[model samples]
Target: MRKFILCSALVLVMTALSGAAVMAAKPVDNDGDGVTERSDCNDNNALIYPGAAEICTDGLDNNCDGLIDRADPTCTAGVCSDADGDGYGFPADPSCSYTQEDCNDTLASINPGASEVCDNGVDDNCDGLTDTADPACGTNPHASNTWQNYPLDCLSCHDQQFNEMADSTHYWWVGDTTEMANQNGTLQGKLTNSVNSYCINILGDWPVCGKCHVGRGKRPDDPQADKTNIDCLACHNEDYAMARTRLADGSMAPSLAGVENPTAEELQVLDGYTQNINAPTRKNCLKCHAFAGGGNAVKRGDLSMSGTDLHGATLLEGTDNNSDPNFDVHMNVMASDLKCQSCHVFQNHKTIGRGSDLRPTDDLARGSEVKCVTCHAGFDVDGGHAAAGANRTDADRHVSKVACQSCHIDHYAKVATELNRDWRYSHDGTPADGTNGPGHPELTIGEDLSPVYKFWNRLSDNYLLGDVAVIDPETGAYPTSRPIGDINDGKLYPFKYKTGVQPMVSSDSKLVALDTYEYLAGSGDVDQAVQSGLVNMGYPSTEPVEWVTTDTYQLLNHGIAPAANVDCAKCHGDLDLATFSELDNLGYALKGPKAQICSQCHREKNLKSDHPGMHNHVDKGVGMDCLFCHSFSRQEERGGISPCDSNATDFVDTNPFAHPECSQ
Candidate 1:
């Protein structure tokens, strides 16, 4: 019995030793390949590792020629970092791959290279371009020589610059749609539907929402040609790019005539040229001067892309068209050398280089670019679209700190063109009171105002004011006034007969008039149908309809018609006032016994002509013009109300009211 027990113990010990050896063994190999877990590099594969010869497998590049896994994007984390970032790798683009292609993560389209059609707020991509087809080939801007009011692929010829811009955040659309444009937003439905929809839905599908799809090749009448601007080709093509054209006189026009308006034969010959287009000023961007510029969207954030560059040597001054390195607008400030790219780090901006992304607006890297308010939006410069008081709501709260392009992307100028007539009349906030309003005169409230933007006031000084007034020489009270008198009212409407009879005083708080019909009807708000008919018939809706006002009475302001509201007489003297025509029988302004406008402001003792000791204030008064010194002019100028004065009304007016005496 003892001998049997000892043998049994020995068997148990043997079993324990065998179990330990199995547990420590290498991973299981269904196919015995002589490789063990301890010696194998890829234990799962029968063939892999340092000594295993490479063979062609659809999964990877057996031979590396800068080609990865024989795929596109060249990624490891299932991402394709190759130029387009399509995850299938550098060569292949499996667009719908969740970890791989999701070309338009925000849109349903799975194509590569998509851009948002801003303003109208569309996603434009099948996987992008709001899900619209962004085929690699079409009437490509990069290939076409002619393009109008469209985004010509400016980078095609400027590959280096284009690459920089590709990863830049300056173009807000580089990011995906998020809180700013999703869920009930203007573009909500279409961005998600990944299909074309519109305000004009053609199939109720195409044309219905087609207005929003417009770009490079589109025309109001052509559906086949639009929507081609969603890719890099739209902006990089030489033919479509706006080259700074030199006129015969040596003046540079805004752009060379693009090949877009070609005749049929011309179009056929050009064949959507895909070549280099030379342009001016690869400049750095200039910060907008709210106190000095002209348009709402200046198109100059990247100064390097300007007509001229900062010349004093450095690239950061006013505008940085690097081509000239020293373009000179604000050279002294530019003297300090530092790349704005270095300071702002825009290239690494979180969502840069991406097309058709669908993230929220806030997700954009914060330091990507400087904001408009960063400089000009101090309480002083922020105001209404029409140089009015600040209401400070939408553009102020949510958007005030944003860049100008955040809202006016790609086609800012064209959009502004449509709204130009309707935003001009206000001095207080909101739009000036008309169907067609006024707009901010110059981009900045600098020294000048747009003629259309110079709001007409109760004290109307338009040339007709001379004839319409019942001037009681004793009272100097001229009530009925002309609209085209002293104000710049824009060269477009230097003279006009307004047919609109707004109650001379409107219950609607916005109206500022130079006697209704003379100014109002001519301001630009005609019946839409009437204007449309006139345009379609080629009957000239823009030709002056008020010949009486435009032809004869129009000569008063500057002794000639200045398209803008800049009144010559208003600045020069009484003889220069809008109504002071040298040929007028009334002999224009300030006639002899003419109640001395000068006497109103000067005490006989201080009159230089009469008082020998009076200081020379005449030249200062003569420096500009009568219109330059008016109460209204006083209001619009910077330091318009004397900086020395504590209150707006405290500034002394030459037309000072001694109402105490008038009361008598």
Candidate 2:
């Protein structure tokens, strides 16, 4: 009887198994996601369905549109998150009920958390109704202004925006510096570490430098991932000012030195924050840039307080109605409503255009967008241009090989600026505010100075914190900034010549950036500062140090001369002794190609020995066509003062007088 019952159960199980196999032959959700195969675009992904919102820029066909990347609008600008696939998204409350208020929209298990308890008549969430009377809330909820709850309150709402800022170079101060290939360190910037002619490295002086940093109260050692460290008001608030603490010695005390996090007392200063912050103003940027290297116009010769307002009422006329044309051409407000942002173009918080002395030169691996050619559009000028007289044929020939600022800018630092600053001399008294103002004494000021010219390919060898200082034997100083180029590499550029007298390790001959914050705040304790600075830079402080002078070059970008007033004879003359001597030293065959060919014209005409002979050559024999020596090409004759292969050591002369075909 037991065997017969077992047989009957086995038969029943066989019948059910056969029935399921037959049903499997039909269309089904193969990957086990909710929808059927035909309805689900990505049947394998349960999260992807016909009504699902799109993800962007990850090289995926998120919306099942076949197209990828930037082709989708979802990649451009969209809601930060929509984890639950609830048609409604979080972060962006789209008038739909399924937005952020629902804590776990995916698990319909949770909605908005229970409301605040009615212990008092106040509204915790700032809602209009009080406590129990508020219909939008429940009772017995826990909440406060504690740090534990802050992340959920703020970070959850704007995580993406914060992430963008956190990833930016402005925040990290350390990124891929492909532009600074010549530097010794892998990470670079004012934050990571840079040794400038002025102020030097910021390793031990975060509080002083942090005054200009975008983030709130962050020192050099702050964690890069701390989103709360961002200080939004610093750049946006017009009324927000950097309040500093000064010591009895008239030096600004470093705020929160050696402190990891800001205290409640430190935060109270920002309690009266401005709500309606605007875009960055000139005043905001100038607070730090204009005063770099200790004081106003101390580091950059092209920039000064005076250049900020170089425009006048007749600016649109393209003529200087208010002041000198050579002060500042681009930033003059009278000509247009332009600002620093106009040329510096910011995207995702990264500003374009780097200084020639800094990074982002023309040869940068991944280049910058800010450029003069953006608006100027090379060589398309008319008489309306300020430098209209510069359009002569002779000058136009050099345009391809010379930067505009090289010739147009006669001089820089129209206003007084420091030509040199020597920090080797010890100050025993109270340290002056060495960063700026009345106390610091190591400065040499100069005005209306001529710039040094160099062929710049936009490459440079910047000194790092520990590199051996490349000192000039004559000057006995290291170059803080130098532009690199060659005749075949790029064009001639004008730069402000700067010199500095600073400290260096005598034993290793390595350049050292001393920590001045502690020294200045400690009433000029040089020994303490040097030892601390060495420790901060990861070097032994036992090494002997000595004072040395160094030279740096900053490219001149201001003080453009009008073409109408510029005298061409200064650079271009048939036989001007001073002009020829200067051009020869700079590798220019300015005397009409060869010194030998020049004798042919003078000898044939028997021109006078004294006075300018360009008049005699042209008026008597060459028929005043000056084109013979100036223009490179005319109808049947070869012209131009220099050979086409300027970089070649030797070449067949291509002149009308020596032309093999013409002579025959």
Candidate 3:
């Protein structure tokens, strides 16, 4: 019976399919020709005999007309006339009028060829005007920025702004500024507008001299031999560049005109959107300094590793291999590449003195390194900038010294992993953020990264916090606080430069060294530099250096608990082996104020997953500081010139961990 039923069903399906094959499609006919569609010569029109008026429609004889489709809209329709007349259609059919050939119906503009006037609110014909505002006049209203439409030429109201530019260093590149003695006291000098005037004279251009000369510009003498023009190629050169440049994996940031991103057909379009983004502003300086590495190192762009490196590896029991030498720094440096602007900023001490207080030059040339006393305001005072002048050795030092940017570069934004499609056309298209996780990072970024841990389950529920601890009711102190000053090492060696060990701090709160891109680029590594002549700034060696002491920092004694049961009785308890992982959440094993511990990472630049593991977690690359990567306990912050660190500590002599980037 089952066999019979299957055969019956198959027969029924076959019959239904056969019926569909015989049916034909529907038809279109402007003229009504009714010969049952199949036999009719013109399926659209019955009114057209073998020969009749050209009543259009049907691909045949409509009204017996020989023409096809050219009826109602053309000769046959009551208004027998072509509007476009190109033999096309009304709007599209170009038959009635060729004037319809004019593509732009709005401005009534016509013809394939015409003048190309950019819509810059101006009429170029010398025929006075723009956008019909002025009738083709001889001149245009110049670029203005005044309460009453002030013209671009500032002379309209003010005198030729500081015309002595021919003699000024800022205007013509000639010399240097005087220096001061200390950060405190009125760093005296002539507070005149003469220097300011020099800049205003040549102010018509984007570079007021002060724009790029950076340290000097209008402030110092740039000299004729080294007269530099503010050219785009100087910074955004494809091969050799000073400023960070951009390229598009997917046009995230096509090179600006004046900038490098150019097409083969033509170089930067004559004044395109290219020059829109401003020249090096203080903000631009920060962009490079904020980050490190291709992305690992950064300037103003800061990241949080707590200690975890770029690839998410942590210094735990089994991950960090001790045998390797560079293992620690390679793995834990946060934003390994540091930028110059990160430290050389306005109102910041790194500028010549401990603060806005700049001093004049002494008789020597150092990397301009000093703690408190540096820039004097002017050049005619007893102990002020008046006492300052170019140091005799300044020329040699400029030639030899790598002030910064010797390595790190603010790489342009990268194309994120996104679908390849014209945004308007994509089915599920999402615009990509110009930067990726690491490709473009800030050099000195702060994180509000609330999540402590994200387990393999791909969720944030299992995050860790540094080992939690409660204040002793008796003493309200926490393990973190400002570190006391110390002359860890008194003897000074002639200064030597080393790179790769990401920085953790600066001397006297000046420049945050390792935290910059320069540090990560392996600046003056030991092999490239002499491990000699480094001098110690602590010549008097007044204070004693202190080593890490758990007894001093109360939180260091406690530890983290397991992932799942983190909030239970485990949280309040004193640290033991089980609670150690909690440190991964708070981002450290240190027990100090956030500043004390935060600065640890603030120094180093690179932090890849491969660095020496610090605590006992996977180092998800989010919860760690610079110390976890630099083996900070071993390295010293160089203040006075020094070939090698006087306070360099040989960690564990029995090394417990190693960063991945460190080669033999």
> TM-scores of all models?
0.24, 0.59, 0.21
Q: Which window of 10 residues has the lowest lDDT sum in candidate 3? A: 550-559
- Cα-lDDT of candidate 1: 0.28
Ten residues in a row with the worst lDDT in model 2?
A: 310-319
* Clash count (model 2, backbone only): 7
User: In model 1, what is the error at residue 344, expressed in angstroms?
Assistant: 9.4
Tens-place lDDT per residue, model 1, 137-157, is 233334454433223444335
Candidate 3, superposed: residue stretches over 4 Å from native: 1-182, 185-222, 225-266, 269-286, 292-524, 527-664
RMSD of each: 29.7, 25.5, 30.9
TM-score of 2: 0.59
Count of residue pairs whose backbone atoms collide, per candidate: 105, 7, 159
lDDT of 3: 0.24
TM-score of model 1 (CA atoms): 0.24
Q: How does model 2 fare in lDDT?
A: 0.53
What is candidate 3's lDDT per residue for 339-446, written digit by digit as tens? 222222211111321111112221122222321111111111111211122231111121112111111111111111110111111122222122111121222222
Query: Which lDDT tens digits does candidate 2 get at residues 424-511?
Result: 4433233433333222535777877877778787777777777888776744668777777755566788888877766788878777
